[model samples]
Target: MSATARVLVDGLGVDTVCALDRGLSYGDGLFETIRFVAGLAPLWSRHMERLQHSCVRLQLPMPDAALLLHEARSVVGGMDQAVVRMTLTRGVGERGYALPTTAHPTRIVAAFAAPAMMGDAYIHGIRLRWCETRLAIQPSLAGMKHLNRLEQVLARAEWSDPSVADGLMRDTDGNVIAATMANLFAVVDGVLVTPSVERSGVAGVARAEVLASRAAVHVGDISREDLLRADEVFLSSSVRGILPVQAVDDTVYVPGPVTRALQRHWRGLGFPMEQA
Candidate 1:
């Protein structure tokens, strides 16, 4: 852990996790990366909703929300701006795939200094590339921020260019899924659209917020051609807010009005969206 980060394990300040933890051994866990402003998590309910849903799906016990929030606030302390990541795993388990008869879930809450605002990217738009790594279609595990992230790790490792902000990933069927770390939205035929997470991809908190907004947003399959020909494109995440897509490979885009509108909406939510 970085010296600037504060950690709490199972409600106690700690830096080490049991080596036999299922999260480390089998990747049996779920996590949420939340942005805190003024010592509060603005989207706390949404993050908890997702975490609860994932707990039910994974059969892992859900920690009490009040306790989780307490731990989150404890780690964040009085920081005006921070990033709090909550990791829940099916505690230490026997050396096998069999589920423990009675499980003791591990809760790790860590708070780090918020990353510097991507002012230039937010203002001029960000550059992206098509990643070779494709997401597998698995409805059973879809839409949850689970710990199995080998695909994203591999896709991210494919690039080292500091100029590239992120990479867009496609599913095995060649449908545009999302950026490695964010959900994608595009304006096609002047209609707002985001690819469905029912088959693959994460249902990010920011994406949910955008969908709940007044905009008529469509959730369906998006192809590379559709994205290329779209009127505008942007990416959304809880921590990063909204990022306009300036280009994908050689295809260039002039950040359009729709992207700006969403950015304003994000700003309205108390997250910062400033130009450098």
Candidate 2:
């Protein structure tokens, strides 16, 4: 079958390709969706680190970062709000699981308009449901945001209510991991606690900053009961930054002291904050 993709490759430049590349074939690839402001990415280094980590795990070669940055800048076209997506595949290969020595890696960089900052996500906070899809125990791939996201997709599909903003996931042993796309944090007993990404969940770039910068905060296994008793809860993501959790199950929170302060620090970190 003929390919329809128009993304660029490291050595081949821009070319027409099929969608049924090995990436689509066996989820044999990795990708990053980065939000750019005024065609600039403050967190490009973080994204590059994660992307390189993923490439190493998948045995996919890292593309020339200098060249990739040029492509990313070119695609935005001076848009104030932009979302640059970078995808790397092991290129086309034979119909098998073994890595092909002859196959070259495919590179793609595209830009789009950014999504609205859930103003309410910062102030009024968000609602969450418990997901039934449990993340698998794979430490080698645990913290990397690989393309194999069927677990998250299935968990997200469990809810259709627009009111349910996101879903909290767990590992196979029922230990809390993170939200479908974002990381989760809770303040129990005035201590900020989040799930340790051991068996599942992508360790978000934003998550690392929060843990390192916040006081008396660290990673741990937080249960539903722990959240119910916590003073506040919030979500974090590379694009979304920090968001308060107003309601979880039948419980409600006033967004707590730590969560609010973190929101302020997060804004100083360069992400947009809720309008006061």
Candidate 3:
């Protein structure tokens, strides 16, 4: 943790995690990164909904939402802007892959200073590259924000050029999945389309909000060609709100009307997307 960060383990202010925690040992956990603006988490409900769903899927006991939020708020301390990352692990257990007969889930909520606003990227759009590292197909873990993120870590390591905002990743089958950290969307022939996360990738809270909007968005498979030929492209994430894609590799894109409209919509929801 950095000097500007505060952490709470199980509702107590703490700076260290137990060495034997399952999350550290086996990556057996789920996490959420929430954006807090003016002491409130605008997408808090969506994040909690996803976390609850993942807990049920992984058979981990769901923590009380009110209690969790209380702890998260306490750590954030009413910052004007901040990022709250909450992790829930199966906790200490006996050696090996066996699940403990009695499980005590460890809840860690950490708050960090929000990243500086990406003004130019949000307005003029951003450049991206294609990552050689591909996501593995794991239907069981698909759409869950599990602790296992070696693939994304490797993909992000492929680039160090500050000009490149992020890298687009593919699944093992070579289908376009998502950016290293954000959900992807494209406007194909005036219709909005986003790749299906059923096979791989996270179903981001920002992406869900876009889908819930009045815009008719198609959720399905998307290929490299699909994006290259699309009229517009953008990436969505809870922290960054929405960012238009100016280019991917050599293929160029103009931030289209759809992208701008959504940016306004996102701002209206209390997540800032700087005006173009």
* CA lDDT of every candidate: 0.92, 0.80, 0.91
Mark the regions of model 1 whose C-alpha exceeds 4 Å error after superposition: none
Worst 10 residues of 3 by lDDT: 267-276
lDDT of 3: 0.91
The model with the greatest lDDT is 1
What is candidate 3's lDDT per residue for 1-276, written digit by digit as tens? 457689988887777878999999999999999999888998999999999999999989999999989988898886878899999999998888888898899999999988775688887889999999999999999999999999999999999999998999999999999999999999998899999999899999999999998458899989998999999999999998889999998999999999999999998988766422
Per-residue lDDT, model 1, residue 14, is 81
Write model 1 residue lDDT over 1-276, tens digit each, in one string: 558789998887788899999999999999999999888888899999999999999999999999989988888888888899999999998999999999999999999988776688887899999999999999999999999999999999999998998999999999999999999999999899999999999999999999998458899999999998988999999998989999999999878888898889988889888522
> Per-residue lDDT of 5-93 in model 2, one digit per residue for the tens?
22455534465556768987988888888867767787788888888887888888998788888888877766777777788888889
Candidate 1 displacement at residue 210 in angstroms: 0.2
Task: List pairs with backbone clashes in candidate 3.
Answer: none
TM-score of each: 0.97, 0.90, 0.97
lDDT of 1: 0.92
Ranking of models by lDDT: 1, 3, 2
Better of 2 and 3 by TM-score: 3
Q: Model 2 off-target regions past 4 Å?
A: 1-16, 274-276
